[model samples]
Target chain A: MDTKLAMHTKNLNFFYGDFQALFDVSLDFGANEVTALIGPSGCGKSTLLRCLNRMNDLIPETRSEGEIYFRDQPIHGQEVDPVEVRRQVGMVFQKPNPFPKTIYENIAWGARINGYRGDMDELVETSLKKCALWDEVKEKLKQNALGLSGGQQQRLCIARTIAVEPDVILMDEPTSALDPISTAKIEDLITELRKRYTIIIVTHNMQQAGRVSEKTAFFLNGVIIEAGLTSDIFFNPKEERTEAYISGRFG
Target chain B: MSASYTGQKSYYGDGMAQNIARRRRHGRVWHILFYAATTISILALIVLLLNIFNAVFGFVLIEDEVPPTELAPGGDLESLSQGELISLLEEYLSVGLIRRFNFEEPLAERSVTDLAALVQVRIVNPTVIEAWSLQESLFQSDMIRAEHAAHPGTRVQFRSWLSARFLVSPQNPRPQLAGIRTAFFGSLWMIIIVIVVAFPIGVAAAIYLEEYARSEIWYNRIIEVNIYNLAGIPSIIFGLLGLAVFVRALEPFTSGTVFGGVDPTTANGRTIISAGLTLSLLILPIIIINSREAIKAVPSSLRESSYGLGATKWQTIWHHVLPASFDRILTGTILAISRAIGETAPLVVVGASTFITVDPKTLFSKFTTLPIQIYQWSARPQSQFRNVAAAAIVVLLVLMLSMNAVAIIMRNRISKQRRI
Candidate 1:
C-alpha cells in the first residue's frame, strides 16, 4: 500500500527444490536511495536479490512464494512477465560478466534487445560516462570488453546495466571481487547512482553498508533479523542477533 | 620415523634412501613404458604414411600393342592436340568401342587427357609389364631393368600413379588409362550433400538437447543415451539401415524418380543422393554429440548474465551461447565430415557402383567416393589396381587433412574474435 516506495516484498519465501533458502521475509526499498543487505555466506542475501528480478527462475526446480512489487505493480503476478520486470529492474553481478564483444557492444546489447531505438553511440558513451569508464575506455570502445582489467570490466558491466535506463539496480556484492581502489571507485559510483535510481546491494562488508546505504537489513539463517537506519543498525540494533552479527560476535 | 642425517645428501632416515631408490626405479620403469607406447604410435603412423607414398610414386615398364610413336604424327604423343587425339581414336578404335566411350561422355567434349587415355587403351593398348616401388627403383634400377629385359618393346619410365592424367581420365579396365575423375566428383557431391543435410539438423538437435531439454524428462534421457550409443555403433550397421531405408524404402526419391529423372542405364536408388544420405546417417550422431559438448562448454556465468539482462532463453542463446561455442562447433563438424568422407561400408551397402566410369552430373547419378574407389581398386585381382588403391589412399588423406586445416583456420579466427 506504500505508493511512494519504489519496490516492496510481502512475506517472500524461496526454495531451491525442497530445501528452503529464504523464510517469510518482507522488505521495502525507497525511491532514489540505496539499501544494503548484509549477511554471512549462505545467509540468502544474493538469493533474495535474485528473487526480485526473477533471476532465480533460470535455476531448475527453484521456486519462490509470496509477492514482490515494483512501484505499485505486483511483479509476482501471473500476468506479469519476468522479462519486463527484469528490464525495469536491471542487475549487476558479483563478478564482472561482460559479453565477449566490443566495449561499445557490451553497453548497447541489452538496450538494443529491449527495443531501445535511440542513437546507440550516444547511449554507450553516456552509460560509460555514468560509470566513469568513458575517459578510460573511450579510445578503445571497439576493443573486446574481456581484455579490460577486473575493475574496468565491472564498471563496464555496470554501464551495460544502466544503459537500458532501468528504474532500480540490484547489485549482489558488486565490489566483493575487486581490490581496495576498485572497491572505493565502485562505492563512489554507488553514491552517484543513488541520486537517480534505487539501489539494493548485497555486501559482506559491514563498513561498506555503513558507508553507502541509507537503510540496512541484516540477515541470519535466511531470515531478516532487523532492518533500520544504517547508522542505527551499526550503532544500536533492536535485535540481539542483529547486534551480535554487527559486532562480529558470530556469523 | 624421526631419524635423520645430512651431508651431501639433503636428508636421510631409516630405510628412506632404500625406499626412495626403489620408488625411483619403479618410476623409471613406468616412464620407459609410457615412452615406448608413444614411440610405437608415432612409428606406426610413419609406416602407414610411408607405405602409401611408396605405392603412390614408382616406376613401371610398359609394352604397347601398337607403339604410341607410330600413332602420333611425329612419334610424340604428348605434343598431339585434343582433336588429333580424337582423330587417332576414331581412326584406330572399333566403332563399338568408340560408341562405348561416347556413351560415357561425348568424345569431342572430353578433355585431351581423356582422348589420350582412349588412344592408350584402344589403340596403343599399353599394359603394365612390371612395376617397382620408389625404394626399389632408387636402390636397384639395374637389376629391375635386367629382370624385365625379356619382355620385348618394353619401355622403362618413372610413373607416379598420382599424375595429372590419373586425375582426369575416367575408370578403365587398363590400369594405365584409369583415372579418378568420376570417383572424385562422386565424393565431392556426396560430401556436399552430407554437410547440407547434417550440419543444421545436428546443431539444432544439439541446441535443443543442451539448452531446452530437461534431464528429468524420460524421453529426453532416452534420447541422450541413444545419441551417445549411436556414436559407437558399427558404421556397417548404418549401411544396412541405409540399404533398407534410403536404397529400398525411399527408392523413388533416392532414384530421382520422384523428381522425374529416370535413367534406364542405372535406374536404381544406389545413386549419389542415397549414398550421401546413408553417410549422413552414419555421422549424424557423432556431429550431434560433439555439438552438444561444445554448447555445454560455454561458461554458465555468461548465460546467467544474459538472463539477468532480461534476455529470453532463445535471445540469450542466439546472441551469446552460440557465439561463444562457435569454434568448438566448427571443430566438431570438421571431425564429423572427415569421418564421413572416409566412410566406406555405408556407401558400399548403399550400392556404390564399382565400375562407375561416368561422372555424377546429378545426385541421382551412380556414385563412388574416394574410399569406395580405394576399396574397389584394392579388391581387384590386378596388382596394378592394388598399387593405384594406395594412390587413392594418399588422395583421401590429403583431402581429409586439407579440409581439417581449413576448419582449424576458421576456428582460430572465430576464437580470436571471441575468447569467452
Candidate 2:
C-alpha cells in the first residue's frame, strides 16, 4: 500500500439535529488508491462520505464533532470554506443527476465556476474521454445531458465531476441504481480513475467492495466494525460481525 | 355434507347471474355520467364562444348625418393626411364642438390615423338605430330590410362591431363611434408595470421562503400561512387595498409629481401607474405561490449534485433550479398577468376613468382598462351600447388568449431546449 495519506478523519461524530448518525469513527484514505465503505442500510456510510467535502452542510441542523483533515489540513475549521473544499474534492451522487444543460455545458459549468480559464472545448473532450464517453457524445456535444441513457448519464456525471480537476472524488452508491452491465462499466472506470485520483466509494454490494477497492472498511450500527486490506477483510476474520455480514448470515 | 353443499351452489347459480347483470348495469350508468359531465363542459365553452361571435358580427341600420364622401371632398377618408382630415373636421363640425375637441387634444398635433378617426366620429356622426346578432343578420335579411324601410331615414348595412377601426379609435358617447383604443393602451401600460414590479420581487420572496427559510421558525410558518390565505382572498379586497395604499397614500410618487409632473391637472394618484402598482400587489401572492411550487418541483438531487460540485447556493439556484423550473414559472406568470388584464373591480375602486379619449401618454396619465370600458358601456341605457359592450368583451377575450398563447409558445421553446 502507498504510505502517502490523501485524507483522514479523527474521532468524527455526526448528528442530524439531536439524532446521532455517526459515532466516533476514524478512517484513512491513501493517495491514488480506491477505498470502499461497505455496510447495510443506515449504517452511516453515505453520511461519512458526504462529510469529506462538507456536502452534509446543505442539510439544516446537521452538525459534526471532531475533525476531518484533507492532505493534513483541517477542513471543518472555522476559516475553511466548504466551497473551497468541494472544489478540490468533488462527488458523484447515487443517482445520475446531470444538470438540465447541454452535454458540453454540463462538463464546462463546474470547471468554469471553479475558475478554469483553459481551453473549454479541450477540457470537455478530455473529461468525456476519461469517463470513456467521448466517442458516444462527441458528435452531439450540444445536446441536452438528460437525453443520455442511464449508464451514459452516470458516466457523464463522472465526467462533470472530474472536469474541475479535483484531487479526490467521493462517490455515494454511484452504481446501486444501475444495471449489471453499467455497474461493471463504472467499476472498470473506478479502477482506471485510481491511477491519478484518490477514490472513496460507499456501496452496499459486498462483491463490488471486494472487486474494486484496495482497502475495505466495514460499518455496522454507525460504527466502524473493521478496516484493512480488501483481501484480508474478505478472507481473514478480524471481527465476527464482518465475517457474519460477508458470509450472508445477517446484514 | 359435501353433496349438500354442491346442491346449494347449483341452486344459487341463477342468483349469481342476476347479481352480475346488476353490476354491469351500474357500470354503464357511471360511464354515462362521466361522459355527460364532459359533454356539458364542452357545450358550455362552445355556447360562450358563439355568444361573443354573435355580437361581434351583425347588421345595423345606420343613419348618417353627413356621408363619408361628403366629409372628405378631395380624397378618400382613409387616404387623407392629418392636415387634410383636420381641415375636413373644421369644415364639417360646428365651431363650438371643434373648439371643445381642440381644447382636449390639439388636432394639429394628432397623427393622421387619429385625425381620420376624429373626422369619422365627430363630423360624420353615424347613428346605429337598430342592430341584430350575427344569426339574425345572416338568416333574416328580409326582416332587417323591412325594419330599415319602416325607419325611412336609415339604411341597413352589414356591420362587424369588431373592426380594425374599433381597435384604434377612442371611446365616444355614440355606440357606433366608440372604440377601445384608450382602454387597450391603459391595460398595456398597467400589465407591463405589474409584471416588471411583481416578477422579480415575487420570485425572490418565493426562493427565500422555499430554499432559505427554516421551516421550524414561527415567523416563517406565519408567512407561509399568510401567503396561502392571500392567494385565496377575493380580488375585491385587493381593490380596496390598492385604493387605500397606492391611490391614497402613495399619491405623489404614483402621480409622478415627485419625479417631475407630466400632466398636472389629471395626474392625481388616479393614474395608470397607481393602477399598475395596485395590480402588482393584487398578483404578488399568486406569483409567489406559483413560483414556490415551480421551485419545489425541482428534484432535490439536482441541488445536492450542484452543492457536491462546489457550487454556492446562489450559483446552484441560478444555474440549475431556475433553469429547471423556468417553464413552470412562465406558466404561472402568464396566468397571473391574464388575471390582472381582466381585473376591473380593483381598477374601478382605484379610480379608472370611465371615459378617456386620449391614449395614455405617460404613467401619470389618467387611464381606463378594457373591462372598465366594457362595464361602463354595458351600464348605459341604450341597447346599442350593450351590443358594443359585447363586442368589447370579444376583444378582451382575444387579447387575453393571444397574450397567453405567446407565453405558452415561449415556455414550449424553453422546455424543448431542455427536453430529455
Candidate 3:
C-alpha cells in the first residue's frame, strides 16, 4: 500500500453531551484513494467521518478530545477556521438534501460564497458533469432542485459538494437510500472521484466496501478492530471477529 | 389443551364477530359526537352573524302628520314618498318643529336626542305657523295647494328620517341634519399613520428575533416570552401606555410646529398620532408573532442545503428563507392591520372624539374613529338619532367586513401559490 497519508487521526475521542461515542482511535487515509469505514449502527463511524472537517461542531452537545490532521496541519486547532476547513473537506449527507432553489444556483452557491466571481455557468456545468448528472438535469438547470427524483437529488448534492473544489470528499452512506441502478452509478462516480481527490466513505454494504475502496477499516463498539487492504480485509481476514462478522455470525 | 381449543373456537366463530360488532357501535357513537360538536360550533357562528345583520339593517321611523281622512290610529310613515310627506308635514307641524339644521357641527357637540325630544313636544302643540297653514288651507280649498299652504314650514324645513344625504354630508348641530363624513376622514388618517409607523418596525423585530439573534441567553428568552405575553395583553392597557408615552413624553416632537402647533391634548383627549400609536402598539405583538411563525414555517431542509453548499448564515436566510416566507408575512400583516382597524377599546381609552367637525389633516390633529362615532350617536336619547346610529353601524361593519375579506383573499392567494 502506498501510505502517503491524506488525513490522519491520533487518539481521537468524541462525546454527545455526557455520553462518549468514539473511543481512543487512530486511522490514516491515503492520498487519491478511496477509504471505507464499515460499522454497525451507533459504532461512531459517521462521527469519525464528521470529525475530518469538524462538521460535528454544529451539534451543541458534541465535544471531542485529541487531534485530527489534514496533510499534517491540525484541523481542530483554534486558529483554523471551521468554515475554511469545511471548504477544503466537503461532505455529502446520508439522506439526499437538495436546496429549494434552481439546480444551477444550488451548484453556484458554494462557488459564490467562497468568492468565486469567475465563469459560474461553466463551473456549474462542469461540476454537474463530474457527478454524472449533467445530461439528466442539463435542460432544466433553472428549475427547482426539489423537482428532481431522489436519485437525482443525491447526485446533485454530490455535484454541489464538489463545486467548491474541495481537496477531500467525505460521504456518509452515500448510496444507502438509493436504488440499485443509482447505487451502481454512484459507485462508478466514486471510482472516478478518487482519480482527482481523496475519498472517504462510511457504508454498511460489504460489497460496496470491496468494490470502491482500496483500504477498509471495520469498527466495532467504537473501536477499530482491523484495517488493511480491501482484499485482505474481505478475503483473508486477520482477526477471528472480522471472520465472524464477514461470515455473518453476528454484527 | 382444552383451554386452547376453547380460545381457538372463540377466535374463529361468532363470538369474535359479536366483539367486532360492539366495537363498530362504539365507533359510530364517537362519529356522531364529533359531528354534533362541529354542527353546534357552526350554528353558533351563524347565530352571531345573524345578530349583527339584524342590528345593522333594522327599520328607520320618521314621524309625520296623517291626513284626518287617511289617518290610522298608530300611523307609520312607510307609505309616504318625498312629495306626499312634504305636503303632510306642511299641514300640521309648525316652525317649532320645522327649524333647519346647520349640518356642520360635530354630532357630539349637539344633543340630537334632546332636539328630537323638543320636536316631539312641538308635534303635540301646534305653533302659530301651524295655525296659519291650517287657515290658509281652509281658504284655498285647492287640495294640493291647500296641503302645501297648510304645512309651508314642513315644505321648507322637514328632513325625512335618516336619509343618505345625512351620511354624505357632515354632522350638524341642527336636530334635522347630521352626518359622519368628518369622523370617517379622521379614521382614514389614523389607519394610514398606524400602518406607516408599525409595519417596518414590527417586521424588522421579527427578522432579528427569528434570523439574526445567535446567543441563547436568558435575556433573549425573556424578550421572546414577553413578546408572546404582550400579544395577549388587553388593548386598553396599550392605549394607556400610548397616552403616557406618545402623548405626554413625546409631545414636543409629535405635536410641535411640525404638527402645526396643535396641543398634544385636545378637549376630547385624543390626537391622531396618539390614536395611531395606541393602535400600533395594540397590533405590534400580533404582527411579530405572525411574522415569526411565517419565518419558522420555512422548511429546515432548505436552510441546511443552502449551508451545505457553503452559503453563510445570512446568505441562506436572505436568499432562501425570506423569499419562501414573504407571502405568509404579507398575509399576516394584512390580518394584523384588519385587527387594528376594528379595535374600539384602545381608541376609546385614548379619548378619541365622536364629534370632530373637521377632518384630520395631520398625525397630531384631533380625530374620531368609526366605532366612537357610532357609540356617540347610539347614546343619544332621540329615536331618530338611534336610526342614524344604526346606519353608521352598518357603514362601520361594512368597512371592517371588507378589510377582513381582503385579508382572507390574500391568505388564500398565498396558500394557492404555496401548493405548487
Candidate 4:
C-alpha cells in the first residue's frame, strides 16, 4: 500500500448546541483508497462525514473542537475558507438529490460556479462516463434530472460532484434509498472510483463496508470503537462491541 | 388469557352495531353541512351576476336632438372617415361646442376612431329617455311600446349599455353620454406602476426575510409577526396612510414637481403616481407573505444539495430556489395585483377624481380608477346612473379576469418548460 495520507482527524469533538454528538473520534483515510465508517442510527458516523467538509456550519449553534487535516493542510483552521474546502471535498447525501435542472446542467452548474474554463460538453461527458451513467443518459442529456430513476439520480449526483474535480468524495449512505440492483451498481462504481479519488463512506450495512472499503472504522455512541484493515476488523475484531455489532447481536 | 378474553368479549357486546351506525350518521351530518355551505356561496354568486347582467342590456327610449341622417352629408354617419367626421362636426356643431371639444384634446391629433366617436357623442347628441331591465324588455314588449307611445318624441329600441361608444367616450353630465375610457386608462397606468414598484421590492424583501434573516433574532421575529399582521390590516387604513404620506408629505415627488413639472395646475400629488404608490404599499405585505410562503416551499434538500456542491448561498437561491418557486411567486403577485385593481376606498382617500373628463396623460396627471368611477356613479340620485355603474362593473370584472388569465398562462408556460 502507498504510504501517502489523504485526510486525518485528531481527537475530533462535535456538539449540536450544548449536546455533544461526537467525542474523541480519530481516524486516518489514505489517498486513493476507500474508507468506510459503519455504525447504527444516531451513532455520529454521518455527523463525522459532514464534519470533513464543514457542512455542519449550516446548522445553527453547531460547534466543533478538534483538528482535521486534508493533504496535510488544516481544514478547520481559522484562515481556511469553508467554500474552498467544500470545493476540494464534494459530497453525496443519503437520498439522491439532483438539482431540478436538466441532466447536462446538473453536471455543468458545479463546474461553472467553481470557475471551470474548459469545454463544458467534454467535462460533462467525462464526469458522466466516470460514474457509468453516460451510456444510459447520453441520449437525453437535456432532459430534467428528476426524470431519472433513483439509482441513476444518485449516479448523476456523483457525476455532478466530481465535475468540479474534487480530491475527496464523501458519500453518506448513498445506496440506502435504492433497490438491490441499484445498490450493486453503486457498489461496483465505488470500487472502481477507489483508484482515482479518496473515498469516505458512512454506511449502516456491515457487509457493504466489507465489500467496498480497504479500511473500516466502527463507531458506537459517538465514539470510534476500533479501526483497522477491512479483513482484520471483520475476521478478527479487537473489541467485543465491534464483534457483537458485526455478528448482528445488536446495532 | 381468561381476563383478556373476558374484556374483549364485553367490549364487542357493548352496542357494536349502534356505534357503527352513529359514526356513519355523524359523517353524513358533516357532509350535509359542507354541501349546504357550498350551495349558499354559489347561489349568492349567481344572484350577483344576474343583477349586473339585468342592467347591462335592455329596452331604452332614445331622443336625439338631430337625427343621423340630418347630421351626415350622405345620411350614413358610419361611412365617414376622420377628415369627413371632423368637417361634419365643424359644420353642424356650434363653434362654442367645437372649441370646448378641441380644448380637451386637439381635433387634428385625434385618430379616425376618436373622430367618429365624437360625431356620435357630440354632433348627433342622442339621449336615453327611459331604460328597462333585460327581463322587462324581453317579456313585456306591448307595455314598452305603450310607454314609448306616451312619450311621443322618443323612439323605442333595445340598447346595450356596454357598447363600443360606452368604452370610448368620456364622462358627461348626461348618463347617455358617459363612458369609462378615462377611468380605464387611469387604472391601467396605476396598475402598471404598482407592478413595476411592488413586484421586485416585494420579492427582494421576501428573499431577505426567508433566506438571510435568522428567526431566532428578536427583530426578525418582530418583522415576521408584523408582516403577518400587516396582511390582515384593513385596506382603508392603508388608504389613510397613503393620504398622509404619499399625498401630503411627499407631494413634491408624487406630483412630479421634483422632476420639472409637466402639468403644474393639475399636479397636486393626487395623481396616478400617488395612487400607484399608495396601492403598492397596500399590497406589499400581501406580496411579501405570499412570496415568503412560496420561497419557503422550496425543499431544504435543494438548498443543501447546492451548498454541498461548493455553491454560495446566493448562488443556491438564484440557481435553484428562485426558479423552482417562480410560478408560485407569480401566483402571489397576481393575487396582490388583483386586490390592488379592485381597491376603491384607498384611492378615494388618496383623491381619485369623481368626474374627470380627460384621460390620464402621465404619472403626474390626476386619475380615477374603475372602482372609483363605479362608486361615484352608484352614489348618484339618478336611476340612470345606477345602470351606467352596473355596466362599469361588468367592464371591471372582465378586465380583472383577463389580467388573471394572462398571469396564469404565463405561469403555466414557465412551469411546463421546467416540467419533470
Question: Worst 10-residue stretch by lDDT in candidate 4 chain A?
Answer: A1-10
Worst 10 residues of 4 chain B by lDDT: B1-10
Those runs of model 2 whose alpha carbons end farther than 4 Å from true positions after fitting are: B1-31, B66-124, B138-146, B263-266
**What digit string (tens of lDDT, one per residue) describes model 2 on residues B258-347?**
898566666678889889988998899999999999999999999988887889889999998999898998899889999999999989
Q: Model 3: runs farther than 4 Å from truth?
A: A1-3, A239-251, B1-14, B62-197, B211-216, B256-269, B383-420
For residues A26-127, write the lDDT of model 1, one tens digit per residue.
999999889999988999999999999989988888898998989979998889989988888999999889999999899889988999999999999999
Chain A fold similarity by TM-score, each prediction: 0.97, 0.98, 0.98, 0.98
Candidate 1 chain B minimal-lDDT segment of 10 residues = B2-11
lDDT of 2: 0.90
Cα error, candidate 4, residue A179 (Å): 1.0
Q: DockQ: which candidate is best?
A: 4
TM-score of 3: 0.77
**Model 1: colliding residue pairs:** none
Please report how far candidate 1 places residue A225 from its true position, in Å: 1.7
lDDT, candidate 1, B76-144, per-residue tens: 676789888988888887899889888999898988776776677678887887788888888998888
lDDT, candidate 3, B1-420, per-residue tens: 323454663335546658789999999999999999999999998875554444333222222442222422343233434444444444556644444422344323445343333333334322212211222233534553455555543332222333576566677553346687877787677778778978888888899998876436678889999999999998889988987887767766556545445643442235787888889888888889999999989977676556655666778778878878877887888788878877788888777876667777766677787778877777776544554566576677667678778777877775554442
lDDT of 2 by residue, A187-237 (tens): 999999999999999998899998999999999988999998999999995
Q: Model 4: which residue pairs collide?
A: none
